[model samples]
Target: MDKLLSLCMIVRNEEKVLARCLDSVQGFVDEIIVVDTGSTDGTKEIAGRYTDHVYDFTWINDFAVAKNEAVRRATSKWILVLDADEYLDPSEKNDLRSFLTGLDAGQPLGISVPIYNCVESVTSGKFIESSAIRLFSNLPTVYFDRPIHEQVVYRDGELPLRSYPLSIFHTGYLDTVRKEKEKSSRNLNIFKDLKGLEEYDYFTLGNEHAILKDYKKALYYYERALTKKTESMTIFPYCRYQIVLVLIEMKRYKEALQYIEDNLKRWPQYPDYYSMKASVYVNLGFEEEAIELYTTALTKADAPAGKDKRFWLITPSLGSHIPLMNLAKLHQKAHDFQKTVYYLSKLVTMNVNDHLVLFQLLNILVPNESVASVLNFLGKIFDFGRADHLVKLLHVSLLLGNKELCEHFHQACVKQNIEMLAQQQLLYALVFNEPDRFERHLPEAGSGSSTGPLNKLIFLAAIVWKREDFSSYLSPSQDESDPSLELLQSMFATLFHPEEVGVDLPFDVNYISTLLIDLFKMGYYDSYDWLIQQYPQYYFILANILGDYFYQNNHLQLAVDYYSLLLDQKQLSGPGYYHLALLYLYQGETAEGLQFLRSAIELCSHESHWYIRYLKHSPATEEKKEIARQYRDRFYPYVQINVVEQLLKGQA
Candidate 1:
């Protein structure tokens, strides 16, 4: 414990994250050395609180200079470098000192630590991991090099390296942080001004371009990195990898496929290359090849990665979750439930906290199986006893419309004495079809928009009794291509905004079609009819479901009225004609029944019942006899067909 590690950081205007950074590793380090380069904010004050070694240097637009200055002040044997926006993961704090001392002495001068770059919201669990030489020997021979994306270089040629399991979370790349600093522009401008740059500079410039969404420039720089004289550069594979990504983002899939195919030959051990190749094949519409490649990728997923110097940029999920998730999605699109479940269940087993995958899995299983069976199947993947697991289960269950499962999870929450969220109560009531419970939680229903699961059920319940206050809950759902939220937002658009047209409902067309029939049962026919007329393309769905509902309810007159509309509109099929004829017959309208029965038989000529009824009704004129003779021969003589014709002849 003789001052084994010193925390060295270079900061400028990082007051927001400086304290959080220093606080995370302060316990692990012997002393803190901070070099401030023109921070006009409270960055220095916060750094001073953690260490007296806070020294200010003139701004030189070079990261290496500031970082070297911080390293110069360290009294410890080992230097642990960090940025103001980066913090040592608290869970990994205790492992630092033991890991430093435990390192095989005199072998590795530079120790790379795993850094997680939080790309979006920190709470979202979305991040990319990379290794950086943050830990190094504090000897004078080992100092920092490069201006941006700086690296630790030993004075006497190539430095022996080792990777440590030091988890550091970097928030500098977060959108809020990026916008505050305008750091992308700063980095890009710095890279742009430099000439006669190295392979690392070109690679770093490519990343900067990619950040700015200038894919062409990114591709240009990445290619330049590959073409440079540095053949054995550690970042060479990454340069090629980034080139493929830039090509992909530009939708140049064919070009990407060739480069990635080449990359696979060189770095065949990395599963991400296969995954990327599969993604390219997907874009090129080679679905089977994509599937085959993804499966092949699984075989190589366990290949030594990140730990290897040749391919340090290993995405852990690429080998397992990425390929499995892709395969699940592919099989799901093909409607192969068995394979979809097989792949998704694998993903769920790996990451139980993956709620998106859990939702997709439940979506497949919940609709076809019983609640008990689904819960049992999911129980293998989840511990229902845990409150967080129970909450996720309850959420996904609601999304899948598994009422009993939602109830089961909700009740489990109750057992845990967990504070039931208003949203949870709303979902519980909605799923269980309890109007009273739903009303109790109405005020707390944060989102009742037409797209939300809560609103879908609320809208269904409202339109079920839609004669009541349904309009207040309806809003125009903007389905800008995010699949989970893409719903038939405009299903009730007619009722709410009658004049709005041409906003087609893609995902929830069936939901609204069935809802229309339910509304008709509750005497809410006008609104549903308006919905159908607005998107008249779904009239066949409305006709089929509404006709069945009318028949099932013993409402013969309403059935006749609805069917007559279909017949009048020429939307009625042969079965629809026969169905209408039956309704007329039930109503004792023999003449109308005869006309529709003949019309039914004319279109659905194979129905012997229609032939038998038609023959019984009409006279045996030559024209009628001709119809009978034709149907009998054309139908290849079902016993009913011959018997109906012969019996009619005998009666004549």
Candidate 2:
């Protein structure tokens, strides 16, 4: 039979993947040409199973040389060259053959096949799609170049390259395989030995350095590559993109911005440049600008064909995923929870395995919206096998006050081997309202078996349920001299024992806050105080809740203390500053009070009225009034300065 297609490959110690590659293209090609470059394994024997024409070649450092030798031995109209780690997708085989049947041996031409490069472990990891000219006419002029990262170039004529739907899966770049092969070190050594470097040689060297995370060297070579880049060089945009990445990695945001801006001007339609600019904006805290740029990048993400080969090297089809996730997180950071949920929902539709996005969406939704609303959405996307999703279901059920749902999920969690301290706490809280049920779940009070941390936590739960009145332990009129040290000391003794506390107490902020709020509701103020006093390290959770609690209850001094603790921990909310300042003013600390007022204005300008109230109360000098007037004009420009002016004049 007249040969139509020749499958050409160079092998060395590729026995592990050789059979899989050959099996994928079993009946697709006419002849197989395997060029063995000194294999020390069963690679040649495996090659013998697929083809009878396995030839021996001396091992050299140059991959191009070995690859060219395989092509040289092919005797067909067309050649399909690939690495042993790569295989033609079986689904794409028929399409590939149909496309090939339409072409003739008129001129040297190449078909750019999409390559999916898997990383980490193949079964559980992600892939990056790239395009490579692995299929071409069997012309003597078409050959590979460079020593390490080779490319097929038609030296005799202009090889008109076109993309096809055919795809290949390459797994040699997987972390597990790369670790065993040490391919980067081998490529780097070969790259270093090459003399009279071309533009691409520099780029390849930069890529090698990038793989090793030597950003400084990568940056230098990428810059050098750009200098030598020709007007028609397809790699120019990729080099620009990589230079920006290297700059960003080096924390040189200023330089990265300049380079990206210049590239965007030169290649305004390229989404990759805009995507990078958005990242730079995020790094610099220009979140709104980042959101704008990311949105702009999404609009331009559908990259046009024949623009650049490097563009096809990455999965341009779903390149928007990166910007989408970035926008979701940026909105999350800005506390635009609606937009956060919107983007995260979109991401979940694309990949349900994005558990982090699911977790983030659930976290915001359960607190902001009703339980029914969250449950309705979770029904569509929930996967019980995912422990994190079970955790979400457990929390949502508890939040809805659905004891039956909580118990159902509790059994599901245990069955699924999902054991968490938060789960136990939630279960304990579900039955705390019923005396009999509460005691049923709670550890025996004062029982020696309940001395361990887990049981001690249960004992605490019992106290919250058993004691409804704490007024006697906490009263303003209590005699300071009446040191009823007995009750206090007994409480301290239970808490102070280190061994009694379980090693695996899940001190999540939400769960801890929930526990504290339950105690406050049941009038167990002393018990709440005991927990906070004993675990002062976890007081940020309590402080956040208590700050608002005290402020709303008109307990100014208590509000001030908790808010100050939160501020010291960098966990203060937008209203925390204003509340703290108001408390300070109530205590006659005018200087500190005004300082926090300014902070409040800077943080949330729309809430400047909070600061204005204190200015309306405090007797301020002209200097203080001028400071307030400036802040109002700067942050809240729509507000009338005359109103503040009149208040400062003490006439209003």
Candidate 3:
């Protein structure tokens, strides 16, 4: 077959990801030409496995020079430029072939492939997408430009380019990779040493400085970029946005607000500006203005492309999800439950795959709504027939300790005949408090290299569960042991094994939370007070979990301990107070109980059934009746809800 596309890449010390990148485009690209600029690793050898057209080049501080060297060696109609850290989506290889075949290669055409730069883990779906002209015709007139932040250009002028439906995932931007490679420092040095810096060059410098947390330098360069000829730069808006972001990072929200407002006038069609302005308003304590601006942002953020070529939509979510999230949080803080759910639910619909969105929605719904109502809401939003949705529901339900809902999701998963992953099995076992299921999946689930800390926590759970002979599940050493797990181990030793070490908790919130739930499950009331005393900081975080768990389970004394702690720390919610009040009332602590109930009624919803419940728990006093009547305008709605029977037909 005559070569239609050639893959050109310049690399050094990319042995870890080189083969994977090459492997992705193996049969798709007609030829592969890898230019090695002094790799001290197996990069050359790995490139050799995929192609014979490997060439060596002397290391220059110039990326363009190396890239042009690689491009000069290509012998094909089209050039597909890639970095060693980037790869085409293997499934989309056919689309690339079709795209190349259909294009008129003789024209000054270039395809701007969206490069998804992974910020954290490449597999973690955390990435930023920027369109780059990575695929272009291999004409003699075409070559690379710039020493750093290089781009392909015609010898005469810029090439005509358009966005395409193809993806290239890059991992070089990841924190681990950035730290190891020090690429930011290299780029910064290149920009610093460049003789005649341009607008784009200044922007690149801003980016590098921002990445290094040198905000002062970043803003200086970004301001310099704006002072240059930015009329043709597609990254102008990005540079502006970066300045705002950096200002936000530096807590200069007022200054950031000025910039955002100025940018909005110049680029009013841009939704991200509105979103950024909203954020500034939030920081400036203009909550209502912030909400209104966010709502405005939502209406305009759905443009399929940038308003003009001089802009790029660098942020994926600033348009919709970001504003939605901000609105949800704002409303939540305002104690407007309905508005919070409304925004979060909208977010849920938009981002079906976003676990955090769905989790927040669940958190809002689960506490306020009935189980059946929550189930219906889930059904409306998610197709539980899908294994992924079911799995998410199951995970969140487990987190919420809603075992009945977990069981429902689990059964639905089984009906779909989905074989649970090891982690899923562990989650299931953990939430359901199923020791046998935990035993069944522990080995495979515990064996992962990165799961050592989690596995140790699981090992501690096994101890709590009194799993016989779980020594095999323990990792060989505590080399990877979490301090949280050790704290748990110490707590266990102090309580059950009195001859062992005393509790010296370097308190870990997550593990302590897990311990509370586990102890609550075990009905080990003795452990509760000890946990509370050992970790005074628990009042802020874990105390609620402790209070809710004990309260919901009707563990009177344990509930009293945590709820009282919450009260002492001023951490108790109205619902929390209601639970504690009930506990105290049941225990004949009448004075404190009545006072707590009154406070609950005062702080909680006007529509709260607690008003009616307060009325019922009487050896009725005039004061209690008067309080209820005064606060609650009508008992009719409440009594209506509580009644199970219909009025006799035609009785009225």
Candidate lDDT values, in order: 0.71, 0.68, 0.72
lDDT of 2 by residue, 447-466 (tens): 33322333334434545554
Worst lDDT run of 10 residues, candidate 3, spans 642-651
Q: Which clashing pairs does model 1 show? A: none
Alpha carbon deviation, residue 462, candidate 2 (Å): 22
For residues 470-564, what per-residue lDDT tens digits would candidate 1 score against the true structure? 44554444543322332444444444564665555443555665556544533445656655675566776577667755654445567667777
TM-score leader: 3
Best by lDDT: 3
TM-score of each: 0.66, 0.60, 0.74
Clashes of each: 0, 5, 0
Clashing pairs in 3: none
Please give the ranking of all candidate structures by lDDT, highest first, separated by commas: 3, 1, 2
The count of residue-pair clashes in candidate 2 stands at 5
472 Cα displacement, candidate 3 (Å) = 7.3
Candidate 3 global CA lDDT score: 0.72
lDDT of 3 at 311: 26
Q: Give the poorly placed runs of model 1, Cα more than 4 Å off.
A: 10-27, 31-60, 68-75, 84-91, 102-108, 116-129, 139-142, 154-161, 169-182, 302-313, 433-652
Residues 435-537, candidate 3, lDDT per residue (tens digit)?
7887777778766665654554464455456553564455433443355344545544443455454345445666567666655443444544455555664
